[model samples]
Target chain A: MFRETTVNTALVAILVAVPLVAQAAGEPFIITLATKVAIFAMAGVGLNIALGYGGLVSFGHAAFFGIGGYAAGILASHAQSYTPLMTWPFAIGGTQQMLIIWPVALAASGIAALVIGALSLRTSGVYFIMITLAFAQMVFYFAVSWPAYGGEDGLPIYVRDKFPGLNTLDPLQFFAVAFACFLLAVLVSVVLSRSRFGLALQGARQNVERVRAVGIDPYRLRLVAFVISGMITGLAGALYADLNRFVSPSMLSWQTSGEIMVFVILGGVGRHFGPLAGAALFILLEHELGSVSEYWQFLLGLLLLLVVLFAHGGLIGVLTRRPHRD
Target chain B: MTDPVLEIRKLTKRFGALTVSDGIDFDLRPGEIHALIGPNGAGKSTLIKQICGELHPDAGAILFSGRDLAGEGSVARARRGLARTFQVSSVAPEFTALQNVVLAVQGASGATFRFLRPALGDAALTGPARAFMERVGLSGRENVPASILSHGERRRLELAMALAMEPRVFLLDEPMAGLGPEGSQEMTAILSDLRHEAPILLVEHDMDAVFTLADRISVLVYGRIIATGTVDEIRANAEVQSAYLGDDA
Candidate 1:
């Protein structure tokens, strides 16, 4: 317990401290990168709930991520344009509040997850992966064709959304928000993995028949896990849009789903701080290695191969001496 | 007579040209181990599956606690107090024996949807789970992962998990499948004690264990119940001898 905590705490501390040190040295760009790492890690954390614990290899989670991005983008646009989202249904208007947009993003993505999960979970293995990827593609195409929001060109937020007390435009302040969301996602993941629902989810992942024989409906458990996972990823999407000040169909693309999967795999699937570590290593590699060569992704592929071939549990597993009990 | 805890009537199943379960009728009265003995292709597993709602019978009625279980899924049947152990030892391989039993206890407790609270720390679940593990002779191996346990231990863990469900009927399929002499003897003793708690629909190959623990013995051949009677009665029957018991009789 102590060793695991020490490792996880060190990772969190370094993630939090490195950006602070960079910001102190007037290198705000490093802080921005840190914010990206935090946001993307949150996204990985979301996917881990379903993929890691529930054993759902959702190749289309970019749907939830992109939906969240759009939620942030569209809402902030309406708030900027001084246009009401809907005049009917009691005159609903858009707000630039981060608190409001986060919940809305979560709801939108969660509903999307419910619909997709309801259908996709009916199948398993390669078929399940394909169905999820297909659903994500459908969303990607819809986003591209919806010209009202710039279509393939994508929507942009004129200004970052406002937090209650912080200047979200300030890179440091925004990093704090992203970090808090990261921590919240981590806490939720940890709490969930120890809960009855989480136990059932993990059990279903291990053996669906055994879970069913125990009188717990594996489908319902998985669906709920998927929905929750989508909501967390969706919240991260909202943060990502604010960070980039853009929401594009690219965000909903299959590539985005693969990147999120990379984060989980690179750190350690189902490990507590796996996403955070994975995201940090990923961003560092992309930044440091991209500056060195255009073939940085090739190096990444090599690293991932080594990890998969040697480190069955990913980076954390390689780093930690003992295997983590799920 | 009072209604049996579990009753099957005219159960029939056909897989293309073969009839796996052919118009079978059976019942389990409360607190009696009714053993079903049959040869390899005689459809014992198929019948167990049909009873456990894993397979749908082409024609039949399965009444549990006098309620007809038609179109009910395995999970629904399990929730309705019909628990089962597999022919092969099956438990959550990654989980500890305690965690596996705790999951079962949580299911039986009807609070599986409760999130936020740590199930590992829940005395309500872990307490009963520990008790069930102890009852199955797995007290010291509570923290051991099910995968690392020996085959007999895994079988015991299966029983522990089934016990945690607080089942009213146990449809155990070959609970003694891979046991050695000592393990089989221990399993026979455990099952003999289990029958008094809830009637078991035991399907077994071990003649010694079956003859020792079975409150009533039923011989199945080609999906048909050829005979149902006491141990002496089944032993005395010439047809049972020639068809099944053979030189052992």
Candidate 2:
């Protein structure tokens, strides 16, 4: 069997090569699809931190993702219309810069995570999952009902947000930006997995009693992980909004949460590059199978069942034939 | 003699109509293996839980050193140098033996928020972690995952984790519960030497090991201490013998 590191390197190389090849071939649609994979993979990476490492099976990560999307959409829209987001409390204005947008998105999602995680983490196992789903539903309904930013119709950015040097309008350039964020998310996952906090978080997941016995509050550890996870996913959501130039209430839906989780489970929960593999596979299947049949999701469901039943570690597990290790 | 490291004053806990711990007073000295021996379902586990802040006693003050531990949670108690090993080995099964010790070391160091630096490679954590593993006679098996380690090895790993904390007191709940004769003897020897590092509140069923290792024995029955004395005194006490030791004595 190939070493996991070798497999991980190959995965990263493939992801990078696919986009470049598409760009070179003048297949802008393929580049866009690849960019979507990267953004979705980044979101999966965020969920993996809390779900895989911290054992917090959050079912409402869509709340953070949508919050991030809205952050970008609201900001860019405000900037375009030359309207301040808020006139009071020191006058917070919206910006079209990716740099500013990313932070705002991250902060928004992070705060939402802190609130949701604080309440959701008070319950464990099934209850935790349910509460998270409930919170995401709340966010989804709020997005749908609110008229400020298109509500159920969703909000759109007239133009893509600006990065420091890149032409955000170009598909290939946007792919590069999305891919960088994806790689950074992967790096953060790797660093976190090997760090002290990662150890405690993993330990808490494995045995909450033991973690407490070791003098670390598992709740606090989980809460912190949830916040970081939210921020990463939120950043991805911001990028995703830029890629589509739109933010919708659907992003906050429970289906989005389930899809993000599917990426993690399909790729390999806890594996550093699991999300990337899962996201790529998901996007590839959607593109290929969508052309073959309208019921592509049914085939996807069958594949997910197979992965869960046979490959407990997901795609990475199948490739490596080993369980995930810190 | 030297002002008990842990002093429990009239600790009482009642679950509905059942009193699991009834005004129990206990003390663990600074350098003695104070063994609390009792029969099955005699609330030995409940008393241990109360001391470790897992189960809050309805009444009584648990003083660690000189400060009262009333509202402090188990995590806080553990952080204050009160380490414990579970009856069933509770080390993180997915973690390597070395990683388990490293976690304990990290917990002891009070810097769990440190991210970016790899924990396994850090000299500060691994160095002491390695020493603890070595001290527990698991030097060669440091990299072995805890899940696959032999039952005895898992016990040692738990001990290594506890030792990594450099605790003030070791709340060892049945450390020899599942061990074979040889494993028990090995654990007995390790624990006999462990008292010098910190005092121990041993809750065990193995009488032979208890008699061999305990500096003082406290016989608990029906949620109360019936006898608290040296090994010889405990062996001679008729109430303790009839209540718990019985045919074993």
lDDT (10s digit) by residue, model 1, range A1-326: 24767888898999889889998899999999999999999999999999999999999999999999999999999898989999976787788999999999999999999999999999999999999999999999999999989899999898999999899999999999999999999999999999999999999999889999999999999999999999999999999999999999999999999999999999998887888889999999999999999999999999998887888778888778577756
> Least accurate stretch of 10 residues (summed lDDT) in model 2 chain A?
A317-326
Candidate 2: where is the Cα deviation over 4 Å? none
Report how far residue B249 has shifted in candidate 2, in Å: 2.1
TM-score quality measure for candidate 2: 0.98
Q: How much native contact recovery, as a fraction, does model 2 achieve?
A: 0.92
lDDT on C-alpha atoms for all candidate structures: 0.92, 0.93
TM-score for chain B considered on its own, for each of the candidates: 0.98, 0.98
Give interface RMSD, per candidate. Answer: 0.8, 0.7
Question: What's the TM-score of each model vs. the native?
Answer: 0.98, 0.98
For residue B148, give model 2's deviation from the true position in Å.
0.9
